[model samples]
Target: MLITVGDDTATFDAFDQSSQVHTTIPCDTSEPGQVLLPHRTLHDVVAKLPDKPITITHMGSAAQFTCGPRTFELPPMTLDDYPPLPDMPPAVGTIDWSDLAAAIREVGAAAGRDDTLPMLTGIKVDSHDGALTLAATDRFRLAHTTLPWDGDDLDMLIPARDILTLARTTWHGDVTIHHDQRRLGFTLGDTRTILRLIDADFPKWRPLIPKDSDTTIRIDRKTMADAVKFTSVLAGDTGQVVLSITSGQVTIASKTAQDGAGEEVIACDTVGNELNIAFTSRYLLDALAGDGTALMTFTQPGRPAMVWPDLPCEEGKVPDADRGHLLMPVRLPG
Candidate 1:
C-alpha cells in the first residue's frame, strides 16, 4: 500500500529513520493497514509535518480509509512484518489486577538503591506449588502477598515498573503470564506487553518483615497524612515528620532552619504505650498515599510502621486502596 503526505501542491514522501514508533499527522488519519510510512522511516518524517496531515493508501489490497480530511488504507501486512504476539497460557489463572498494581507501587516507593540495599526493583512471581507469591523488598522493609493461580514450573522476576504499567493499563480479569527466562509477558484484553525480567538474585526479604509487634496505633489515615504533608514543608533535606502519640491525640510536627515549625493533632484510638516516632515525610507520604482513606493500623515504635486499609474501603473512596505501605522511622537528630 502507498501513502502520500501533504497536498499535491507540496507533496513529499513521509518516512523516518531513527525509531520504530507509530506516527500520525493531523489531516491524514491513517487506518489499520495503511502503510503511510515504515515504522523506522516514520520518525524522520514526523518532525517535518508536525502540523500537517499524512494520507496512506492500500494500493492493490483490501483497504478502506476515512477521517475528516485524512484517510488511511493498507495492503495486507504479512505475518513476517508484524511482531509475534506474546504467548498466552492454554489455561489461565485469576488474579486481582488492582492488588498486583498496588503491590508494585508500594515496593517501588520504598525501595532504595545503595551499597547496603539489595535489589528491590524486582517482583518475584512464584507459581508456588498452588499459589502465586508476589514479593518485594528494599533492605528496610518487605512487601508480599500470595494469590491463587494454577501453573507449573517455578518463579519469574519481573521488573517492577513493567508490572505497574500493566496494572494501570489492564482491568481485573483472567491474567496469563508467559515467560521465557529473559522476558515476562502479560496478556490483558486486546493488548499484550512483554518486558525483560530482572535477573539479579533478590534478597531473602521475608525474614526482615516483622511478624509480631509490641506497640500499634490505629488512626484515621487522612488526618495523619494531611498533618505529615503540611508539616513536612520545612523538613528540608532530612524531611523529618515527627509523630508524637499520647493517650488521646496523635501529633505530627516538623521544623527546619529556614522555615519555622508546626504541628497538627488528630484524635486516634490508641493501642499499647504511647511513644514518639519520627519518619521521613517522603516515606510517610508514600505510605499515606497507599493507605487510601481507611482506618490505618500502625505497628511498632522506631521500626517500619505498617499502614493497612480498613475492612471495606468505601466505593470510589479508596483511590489507593490496592496498596499497603511501610515507613521506616528515622533517628531524630538531637
Candidate 2:
C-alpha cells in the first residue's frame, strides 16, 4: 500500500495481487508528502483515535500523529518497497449508480457459488446500442435485467463477488468504466477500482428463455410469496412446492413423510388454460422478493416459469424487456 499526501488531497492505494482487486481513494487533506505505511497498523491507530482534527508529521525515521491532547508515534516503512498502481485503460462507457446496483442485486442471486464451475460464478454484462443487459445463472435457474445506456457493442464477464461488493459500497452517482480486453476499471466519486476480467466464457443464455407461454397469471406478488413461505415448512429434503392454478385461485402445497403437509391459496386472475407445476421453494421466494405487483407466467407443467414486475404495458401483453427471473420447474415425484 502507498499513501501520498498533497497540499489539498490525500490518497490511499492498495492492491490484492492474487485477486487483482485494486482500489485508490483520494480525499481532501492538508498534509503534503508521501510515505509507505503499514496498512493494518495505520488503520487500527486511526480508528481508535479521538474524533477531533488530526495532525501527522514526519520526523526522520518515524511519523507522529497528534489528536486533541494525545500524541502517538509510529515507524514509517521504506517508500521504495511499495509497488506502483495499475494504469487505467481507455474509457469504455458510463452507467448510473442506482441502475448498476439494482441490476447487481437482481442478477447476482442466480450466480453460482460453486467454485468448480468458474464461469457460472460471473455476471455477464452485454451492452448494445442504448441498452445494457446483466445476467447470471446457476443451472437450475437464471435471473436477468436490462437498463438504458449509451454505448457501442461491448461484452464482458466480471467476477460476481467483486462487482457486487463495489456496487454496494463505492458506487455513489454515475460510474465511468474503463476496459481493455483483459481488465476492467470503475471510477465512482473519490474511489476507483480495477479488476481482472474472468478468463472463462459465459454461457449463451438467450435461447434458454421460452419465448411464449400457455398460461399467464396475474396475482399480488406479496400474496403469492406469503403462500409459498407458509407451505415451504413441509418441503423437506426436496425443497419442493406444488402450484395448482384453476379458476380464480392458485393453491400452493408441500408435503413429506417425516414432516406434516401444508397448503395455502391465493386469489389470482388467470388467462389461457389451468396448469399445475412444481418448483423449489427457495427459488420461488427469491424471484418474488420485490414488491408484490408483478405477474408470473407459466408455459406447461414441466417448463420454466417467468416472473416480472407488473410495470405499465399494453392491455394484456408483457414486454420482453421487463426485468425478471426465469425459474426452472422441478419434476414432481409420482
Candidate 3:
C-alpha cells in the first residue's frame, strides 16, 4: 500500500487499485514523496508504541517512527510488487448493515460445522417477490429468518463462516450488496467485502418443521436460558439437559454416570400436556440466545420440537415458516 505524504494531508489508500475504499488522515508532513511500507508490518510496529502522538520521517531508503523516547525504523518495499485487489460486481441492492447482520446471526446459528456434510455448512439466501429468507441446518436442528429485499429473485448458498463475518463485524452505514452466480459482495461505508458462494445445495428444510403441538412451554426467555445454563452443568460429557413440564411450571435437570444430578424448577405461563423432553444443552442454549418470551412446542417423545420468540398463535394457526428453529430431541439410553 502507498502512503502519499502531501503538504496539507496524508491519505491511507487501501482500496486504491480496486477503487473500492479510501480513507484520509490529517498529518503534518515534511516528506512529500511516497513511502511504500508493508501494511501488516507498519500496523504491528505502531500498535506497540506509546499512547503519545507519533512522528514519522521518510528517509531515503527507510521510514522511522518516533513516539516519546521509542524509535522504530523499517525499510519500505517496492510499490510495484503489490497485486491489485479484485473489484466487486455492481450493486444489486442496499440494506441496513446492522439489520441484515442481525438476521444472519439469528438464522445462521444452526449451520453445521462438520465438513462431511458440505450442504449443511452454508446459509441459504433465497429471494422472491422482494422478500429474502435465510436458512441453515446442521441435521439435528434448523434455523431460518426473513428480511425484505428490493432486489431480483435469486438463490445463493453461502458458507456460514464467511457470511457470518458480516454479522459478527462491527461497522456503520447501510450495506450495498453485489451478487452474481458465484460471488457476493458488501460495501459498508469505505469497507468492501467479497465472498465466494458455496456450490453445495442446501437441504429442503421447510417440511421438517412440525405444525402441531401436544405440549408447549412458555416462559421468559432469559429465565429459561439461565436455568438451562445453570442446570446443564451436571450434564458432563453428554451435554444433555431435560425439561420436565407440568401445567404451570417446568424443571430443568441434568445427570450423568460420572457427574452428579441437578435440577431447577421455574413457574411459567404455558398450556398443553405435561411431559419430559431431552435436548442437547448447547442446542437449547443457542436457540434461546435472543430476546422476547420463549415459546417451545413438542409433538411427543423422540419427535422434533420447535422453539420460537413467543408470538400470537390461535387455534389451527400455522406458525411463521421463516422465523423459528426446529430441533430434534436426543434419546437417552434405555
Q: Give each model's whole-structure lDDT.
A: 0.57, 0.81, 0.80
Per-residue C-alpha lDDT of model 2 across residues 1-334, encoded as one tens digit per residue = 4667776766777767413344444445655788777877887888998899777787868888899988888888888777666788688778888878888988998999898998999999888768889999999899998898885566888889888776677456788888888887877766777887888989999888776767778888778888898889888888899999998888999988888899998888777678889999999888988875777788888888888777543433544654789999998747
Per-residue CA lDDT of model 1 for 1-334, tens digit only, reads 1233443222222212211111223343333332332533443444444355443455655334434454444344443454423343333344566665656665665554453433566676676567666776565555565666666555767666555655565457655555676665555554445566676787766545444444455666667778888898877778898888788778889877778888898887665567788887876776666444544344455666656565443222221332355556778656
Q: What TM-score does candidate 2 get on C-alpha atoms?
A: 0.84
The CA lDDT at 287 in model 2 is: 90
lDDT of 3: 0.80
Clashing pairs in 1: 15-41, 16-41, 16-42, 16-44, 27-53, 33-74, 34-73
lDDT (C-alpha) at residue 281 in model 2: 92
Ranking by lDDT: 2, 3, 1
